[model samples]
Target: MRAADIDKLVSVGRPTIAPDGAFAVFAASRPDLTANRAVGQLWRVDLPDGTPRRLTRGVSDTAPRLAPDGAAVAFLRADAKGKAQVFVVAAGGGEPVQATDARAGVGSFAWSPDGARLAYTARTPEQGRYGTVEGLEPIAEAPRRITGIRWHANGLGYLADRPAHVFLIDVPSVDAEPFYEPAPAVRPEGEDAPKKQLVAAEAVQLTSGAGSYGGVAFTADGSEILAAVDEIETDRRDLSSRVVALSADGGTEREVLARTALLSVDEIVVASDGTVALQASGVGEGRVDFIAPAVGLYLLEADGPRLLTDPDVLDLGEVGSHITAVGDDFLVQSRSRGTVSLVRVSRDGATASVFDGDVEVAGHAAAGERIVVAYATPDSFGELALVDRGALTDFGAPLRAQGLVLPGEREITGRDGYPIHGWVAVPAGEGPFPVILQIHGGPYASYGIHLFDETQVLVDAGYAVVYCNPRGSAGYGRAHGRSIRQAMGTVDFHDVIDFLEGVVAGDERLDGARVGVMGGSYGGYLTAWTIAHDHRFAGAIVERGFLDPVSFQGTSDIGSFFGDEYVGVDPVQMAAQSPMAVVDRVRTPTLVLHSELDYRCPLEQATRYYAALKRQGTEAEMLVFPGEDHELTRAGQPRHRVQRFDAVLQWWARHLPVTG
Candidate 1:
């Protein structure tokens, strides 16, 4: 795929199965070149050999939830103010009616058991803040008091002043007419009577106080809503969450269900019998640990909490993974050997694969005996496929027609004889071509079977792309992931070098002498470190790097505990692993790319690295994008993503030019 192919790329997500297993609804999104934004809408497909068809027409619609009674489908759609709110439409067909008018918009929502009401979470901003009162601008708002560690987030800035709270709103009846209230009688004498004002049903706030709530769900009887609450205390350091039970009627205070003190909960699911299932990871010594002991499944029963899945064996996807309770057991998405599959874990920790193969399962939903999954492979983007049968809808067919290069999978032997899984994507030419060693962010993140656009773009530019999941990467077992903890640039660095060398030695179409290394975040750290230790690359691109852990801890969002867990606290020990300490040894031409608004790694990392390289008389350049966070390549603006691709190609052309 070329750089412009990004506009034609399509993916499907957020699949929800009907209660009777008759149909499934999902959301499909594609970039709009004209508007320079992503456009999404709802799509539906009937079960048992039925064609998929468009269900709703919205600019941006996502997070579809099928009602319990199967009479309606509720989803989030952006309003005129660009805030996502809940909208409901009939299961068969009809216009979608807006059910909420929240000022701060909704984060997530779930249908009640009886399908009469919906439970959702939204930020409850202070009355005088966030434009809550008319004529009060954000710039004119009062200054915030310094209190919490998590006061500022990456995309949502200054969150301490407006903590999220649970809310309940009744669904509007499709057959009923629009409700309106008369205007006040005290109008100006010169003007005629004002038109009646349309009034939406008010939503009741369920929880309050200095905390944020998410992942809401109702019990079997729909009496209480279970939500995960994060209370940021100044004394506490670990970012953990507590499960709470709130009355659905807003009649009483929320009751603490489970503390989950030492564990960090990413998602939660409630069973029919009031059992709470959590996908959590252990934070040893109350500090965030890296990559080791992957997130596992835990059950909060009446007696106590019990481990349901083995963390060493199965790594829960956590980001796009879904957990559904089935009787006494649960079905969740787990990553193993670079592939994500749906697994069934019994109450006693007996794990069985429900859907396992070469595909990367992004999301899944099931009801009764019927199951559907949204998956992606090396050639296809995410598609809606049935359990036993193959793909039911081809959402990526248009992009596939534009020609996508499929990566060839390989297994390399590391310096220590450990096996490293990797892939190589070569251009369509016959002669040898320059190679690009691409590294993924999150030293824990892996390069999987998904069709990545970055690799494809390089291949289309007549350059070979190589990527591997060395030690410290996820999707391998816990031992493999934790092998490099506190020893970042030692064995993991050797493993990366070994994998790249092994691929070059075996492949005939790659020119090893002309290679360019590039990566972002943790990958950027490794790229900078790799060029410094071994001057084999002609050029390098370091984007959003964590060059110094000491400075990162003070500025980054997760920096407070991330460096302490991975790099340790000793200044001398941290210096040995940091790239900033050894950047003077670099001789390769480098391009330092960064985002101005990125809070994950912060912009100082790029500036510091670039300045050090330039001061030492080494060739260097820096590129900064405005109004973008750390997720620039993945979810940035469409025009900006294309512009980034153009810039990368220009850098490669100047340093390691690919020739036929």
Candidate 2:
């Protein structure tokens, strides 16, 4: 498959099955190149029989929550003004009506236990005109002051003075109507028509003050809302969060649980008996790098927050791990060694793997033993699958019909005796095909088991694709990852190069001399490192890479934590880990791609390395994508993604051309 084919795949996520299990709804997204947009909408599939259907539409609509009564579904969507507001519609279908008029837009939300209210979090407006003038006239060129460690974020730039606070919106009763005359677009079901607009429910601001709060959930009686609190402080280099319960009516609050400087709390779910289930990180410490802090599952009871699962035996699975319907048990989407699986862990710390193999489960909805999930594998895009009593049923028949070519995977021994997992895709009718070693971003994140579009495109262009999880990658215990802490270029570089050496030695079909390397973000940093220390690669592509940890610590949006987690703010260690420090040693022809608005890595990180390579007289070129950030390759415009890949193919063809 080619990069342009990414628009054709229907991506599924946020699957929710009703309490009674009559039907299920999930958010599905599709890219439209002709329209220059990607739209997300909800789809309802009849349970057991499984007939998929769409429910709402817009630039993007996600986060499907089934109300307690199962009579309606509340979701977050952008209104006509392009602001996210609460909206609801009958599960059967009809025009959806806006519920909240939150001007600043909602970040996330949850349905109360009784479903009569929606608890949400939205950013409050900046203190009026910098506390002086009334509007834009006062702040156009006004000096913006900063006193917080988290001054900037990746997608959102400066934090300003605004804070995101918990909000409550009441749901109207079944018998209600708008108090005004309707517009001409309204469909008059005459007295027979179901209710169009429920009596307008007032939006109420709950918790307010210094901290920015989110991850909203409900107490058992539905009289209070619980949230994860990020209390704003002078120095927040130490990441942490506390759980707090706020009065549903918006007046009172009580601190429920507080963690230490090492751990952070997320995804807090409360049980019927007031038992709290939360996923936390930093249970086991002593590492300096960001990848070693393992997330452990915990349960909160009368005593306090108690660790429920051991990180040594089982790491809290993927980012979607949550408290399960069975109060005592919760489903952990975990990554082990290299593969992702679903494991069920109880409050007492007993853990059991429900399913483990060559599959990546994104999200799951459970009703006793009937657990259905949104998952994918090597060849399939995102699809719905059911795991009933340990037997698997694949609902991705249509995706299989699309004929996506999947690569074969294998495990290799690193030069240091660690197991490195990798995948290879060879072109049809190939003999000694030119090879390209692909690296994934997030030196801390691992590659998925599914068919990645970029790798597939390279394979289709008559190149052998070999990609793997080097040291410092996730899913392989904390020790293996933290191994590259003060030693980034030394250990991780040798791991990939040595793994490539194994691949070329084992496969006679690969042309060892004509090989290229490419990656973005952390992947990009490794590419820069590979070219610096190794001369075997003929070409290299580095996109938004970290050149020097010292510079990164000062410029990056996440700069505050890099000093503590990456290199400890030492100058000698920073220079040792920098690719630019040894730029003159690079002999391979390289291509650099970067996004203009990427605050996470920052644009200067790219320009500095590009200038150094050119100054050294190495054959190099740089391409910049305007109006895009670090996620350019993943979530940027469909056309832009295709264009970026096309450029890479062209550059590789010129540098590592096929020769008999």
Compose the digit string of candidate 1's lDDT tens values, residues 1-660: 888888767788969988888999999887777788899889999996699888998998898998988889999998778889998988886888888878899998998888999999999898899878899888888888967666677877777888999999988776667656565787777878766432257789888898899988887788988888887768546655677888887636555544545667777787877777888777665545545655888887766567788887788844688788766778888887778888988888998898888888888888886889988887777789888877898877877888888889889998888998888999887758999998877877788888888998988888999899888898888788888888999888888888899999999888888888999999999999999999989899999898989899888888767787788889998999999999999999999999999999989988988999999999999999999989889888888899999999999999988862
lDDT, candidates in the order shown: 0.84, 0.76
TM-score of 1: 0.96
Best by lDDT: 1
- Residue 456, candidate 1: C-alpha displacement in angstroms: 0.4
Worst 10 residues of 2 by lDDT: 389-398
Q: In model 1, what lDDT does residue 201 have?
A: 73
lDDT of 2 by residue, 1-660 (tens): 766777766667757777777777888776668766677788887777666777776568877777876778888787766778878877876667677877677888888887878888988867554323445575474576877766777876666566789888887543345455444555666655443443387778887786889888888888888898875457555566678889987548898876553457768877667677887776324422245666777777777768877776676646666655554578877777556777887767788887678777777776656676777677665777666533133444554565555777778887768778877788777479999999887777777777578877887788998888888888787787787877787777887887788888899899888899998888998899888888888899999887767678778987777644655557776777778778889988989899888998889998998998899899999999888888887788787788898899889889987663
User: For residue 517, what is the lDDT in candidate 1?
Assistant: 95
The segments of candidate 1 whose C-alpha lies over 4 angstroms from its true place after superposition are: 179-199, 254-257
Q: Candidate 2 — which residues are off by over 4 angstroms?
A: 127-141, 172-199, 283-289, 389-403
Clashing pairs in model 2, backbone N/Cα/C closer than 3 A:
317-333, 317-334, 318-333
